[model samples]
Target chain A: MPKTAFQRVFPYLLVLPTFVFVALFTLYPVTRTVTDSLYKPARRAADPSVFVFLENYADLFDSTHYLGARFVQILGNTFAFTLATVVFSVPLAFLFALLLNRQLRGTGFLRFAIFYPALLPLIGAASIWAFFYSDTIGLFNTILRGFGLTGVNWLGDPNVVLYAIVLLNIWKQSSYCMIFYLAGLQNIPRDIYEAAQLDGAGWFYQLRYMTVPLLRRTTLFVVLITVTYSFQTVEQLQVLNQGNPADRGNLLLYFIFQSIGERRNWGYVNAMTVVLVLLLLAFTLTNFLLFERRDDDKA
Target chain B: MLQRSLRMLCLLLVASLLAVTPFVQAQAQVVVDFYYPTAVDGPITQTIQEYATKFEAMHPNIKINPVYTGSYTQTRDTIRTELAAQDVIVDVAVMLATDLTSFVEEETIVPAQQFIDRMENGEAFVANFFEAFLANCRDEEGTIWSVPFQRSTPILYYNADLFRAEGVEVPRNVNELIEVAQKLHTPERAGLLMPVAGGFPIWLYQSFAAGFGQPLIEADPAKVYFNSDASLAAVEFLTKLGMPTSEGGFGVGPMGGSVWGDTPTAFTSGQAAMIYHTTGSLTNILRNATFEVGVAFLPSGLPNENGEGYAAPTGGGNLYIFAATEPEVQEAAWLWVEFLASDEVQSDWGARTGYVAATRGAWEIDPLKTLVEEKPQYLVARNQLAHAYKEFDSYRSIDVQLIINNALSSIISGNVPLSQAKATLDAAQAQIDSLLAEYR
Candidate 1:
């Protein structure tokens, strides 16, 4: 049962380049971002890189920028955006995958149409939606005018804009999730469904039990990716609203971006980045370790 | 058949693009990565490539690789990211004039003054630039960090045909503007459209501030005078224009929906009679507008006791040379900047691109003069230059801008009270003061 030393070393050597690549890009950035939060520019330090820990984090939390309106609102917005997107996109994608899984005429064409939004550059898609939301000459307004109703400012009004982007984020991500679900559906053997039918289980019951449990792994993967995508919601926010109506659409990553690009507060930005990374890591781990493991424990 | 042809064409296009670059970059000793933004809406990237080609022919020793970065904001981010990642990259970049302070703080760009000093007629070359255009490009120490390249100003573009039909003259002041708007407003058409979007709200707001004879930011970039009596009157007056007639104000309504880009379309499509936008959009307006477009200075606030026109803000990008190991590279960047600024080049560039020439002398040049005759709108923008001052910029410029932008967005939405607007300014001033505290 003794393994040759070369066999063990060979596996490590084969994976060495990939490990280095991941470490350099992924692990290194995470560590650097964490360390960078500890540094602040000091007048006495000629280099402008002094290690003043936690100052950046403190400055960000205290209502610094928007008079008395702190980042508490922004974090709330990010959470709302993430939860709304994951909730709508995962179920909707599953619905789409179920619909398309049928051997029906025009299924191929329907799939293409459903997935079209995902193919366009997200910023460009945001622009198209902005035009639709535009008051004077937008499609929605034009339709509203035809209906004798006043037009809604979808991207400008604070109350409506968040939902506007939520609607858009769902549109953008549903198709992306659908592909994974479609693959998962395909992987589920047809005989399993046939056996369910033979057992007198209805389609609804089959879907709730056989199909849902079978696709747990796919749903987990989709949720993980979608949650990550939701946090990094910059492109559409910039295009449609630029995080406007008093930062109503301002998500966490967008705030981090503005901190770096707008404020040049490197230490503060890194602190926010570190916070976001930790939150995301915790989210990912909880999904996989807790909810994701429940099925295995049951098995 | 169509799909097959499209695929073939795509393959050929890709092949040709791959084939051409190696041949061009091969013979040059030094290749400059020149990144620029498409500030003006046009075939600007193609124009840049043509200019680069000419520069390459003139300087056989140097090859220029022009990268068309998307927008001014994107270009700034691209340079910042590239510099942060690569340390020393992008030999030269065209960035927002207001970005000089941040770029200097980041150490991504060197004082272009050094590059100017090493050139032939370098001193004269630096002096030839208009000082107003240089306002945002210099630090507090008066160090010139960038060369004015593509510059523009905010102005009022009116629907001349609509004005003629309504028998309305171009409004000279805020009171008169509302009077004219009263005559022009229809159930179907808005009397005016101006941008209050998060993108360039501050630029257009400057035109209003100047009307009240106050600059938003004092010459000292650190000091902001936003809550002054004049500023309150100016913004409240603007708010009144968009306030519904039912609200004891003009019926234009908050127009919170009309973004800067949408403003131009509103005027062009004849949905709105007047619009406030950048002169950078003049050519695009002219090309697309069906009606005869009239160009005029933004409506001034109550003229000062001396009766001066409302001040406009100079806006656009300037070229900055980042420090690199090779002196030759910096030298090449200097030459390129000079070429871009030269009267012969800028005069034609201004005319073709609708950007104002950076140098006063360029206005006298034949290319610009001839274009002025062809399109009098060019002269109107140039004439406004005298009233135009530098854009309000300061250290931590982006942070200050975002604070102001959010405030403007809030005010224009009509939900926030004017007092909230004042409070927003107060908070922004505090934040900006704190941002500069580090430098101290």
Candidate 2:
């Protein structure tokens, strides 16, 4: 059957504006990033433009630098940080959410206390943590000194700085991630827990067996989100560490920020950004597929 | 009846005149969309807005609309993005003096001298800033692209009471700094503190390098001496200060971890006997310090073999007038710049805000002189002006600084061998060279 003119134009009309918007906002930048990464910018205003493909990438992979202080080391630290935050924060969030779900005195106030860090801006939170980490007047060190012990330089020490940030992030992220878990826990029928209890299952047993399996969907969501954010988090580093002393907290995002934003090395930052997006995409896809398959098997 | 009609006609004429007057007045007013960004302090914006209001009242024909962009970098990005959109988003802006090269590249801002050349007292106004500050605003061709607004230099702030208690004088050179720091070091107190986080190590080290009679940037903008013997010696001096207690680095204290404002916090808490920071921090330090705060010149640089001491590096931002073809808007921007640069405004700003008034005339003003008289601490930064050099600013300013800063951090923290510091600096020089070569 021959289609009318209206039919022929209908699909294109429907798709074109959305495509244009996406292209303007997203695809255009993505393409520009890819192309821009091929050329080095003229450093001096008077210099003519020149293309230097793959040179920026080569700089990243420079092998002459120390293993502990190289670009690869920064990437490794980013991954280690992301994984550590997820592993530690997600379960803690779940546990808190479960406990808060019970009708208990002070639970209302308790939820606010847990969730307040999420309310503060990330940099503000970092600053607060910096106060606690201060050697002279900081609570952590002051308390230690009162006991006749030497104070620790939490953010100053290379070995302890990353963990100190991680601890602050956990304190912050668990509060935020708890909200999602609370909503997820609400969806779980109370009957399952009551039925398990009737069968004389302990609270720990119920939490381990039923709660864990039931919260799988929530756990996947929490993991996906927390993982994505942990890799990109730069505020704490910018505020406290700035990925100092061997790029301890220099995530891919910060590397991009310092390289491109501060230095005008857009080509190198674009190259790094491309790699970062690909890694994140891979991570998201793996999580999505693994979870979706698990659900399919159960069904 | 004829007289009554004449009176009605007169009233109608008056009403019509009033109706037309507003439209004419609106057309007469030139609106200057100004972008002013303060990265360090938030309150400075309120002060700027008040100044804008005052300017508006004085120049009824000119209206100043001030937009407070978030940070220095954010302001640059926003202006760049705005200009890229083919929009004149701002007619005048306060941006980092070091950003002159980039603005010139984009043609987003015009040379202040271009506009200043026509105004009364223009030449003197252009030259009013401290010599060290004016250098940052000049291009290689000697065009003055911006006029100084907020300017500062590093100064030494120590606990006067602590020094007295310790029975020691303030450190004047590397030897004294180390010796005094060792004497002052305790489990509870680090003798000295200077921030090393992010790009600060380079910022503060410029003072040391200058005092050693080594300039970081050559006369040629394209060439820099980051890995030079002098800079290495400066870095080594810096590393020694932050060395472990066993290694005699008591001077660095817990400064490796503290960045920016925290250095002041460390000092005010009595954990640090002396600190190296900007004079901009003086007011905040004074307000918080429980003990007597002493302001002094930065430890005289590691004296050269000839016993010459180089000056401290001047740092801060300037006001750049955005390029506009419209004569009225361009003229209005100059008015705003000149007003902001006036001794009255500069003095008021200097007194209220901690930033040093950039204009030499501002220092001569009676109120400002009285301020210097009342708190001699305010004079330390100004006194260092004679010894001050232009800050190490180039086209890719942050990039170069970060490279050097990271190297210092590695030397101090990685406990890397001295040879490795050279390697790190060589890598920086290579990167900086690559960045500048195409333009050169």
**For model 1 chain B, where is the 10-residue window of minimal lDDT?**
B301-310
Interface RMSD for candidate 2 relative to the native interface: 4.0
Q: Give per-residue lDDT, candidate 1, residue A135.
A: 68
Give lDDT tens digits, candidate 2, residues B1-440: 99999999999999999999998978698888888777454388788889999999999899898998877778887876665455766888888877877677656677887777777777777667788788888888888888888878888888999889768886666677777877888777777777765446777877777676678885566777887887887887776666675755454476353455677888998888888888788888888899999987776766433334746888778988876437779889889988998888988888776788888888888678898888889987887787788888775666666666766777766546655888878877777786667567
Across the candidates, what are chain A's individual TM-scores? Answer: 0.91, 0.89
The per-model DockQ list reads: 0.33, 0.38
Docking quality class, candidate 1 = acceptable
Give per-residue CA lDDT, model 2, range A165-265, as digits (tens). Answer: 88988998998899999998899999988999999999889988988888888888899989989988888888777777656556667767766554356
Per-model tally of clashing residue pairs: 2, 2
Off by over 4 Å in 1: A1-5, A42-48, A65-70, A191-199, B1-33, B56-65, B81-86, B103-128, B138-143, B303-309, B323-328, B438-440
lDDT of each: 0.79, 0.77
RMSD of 2: 4.4
After superposition on all C-alphas, the RMSD of every candidate to the true structure, in Å, is: 6.7, 4.4
lDDT of 1 by residue, A63-101 (tens): 764422547788889999999999999999999999999
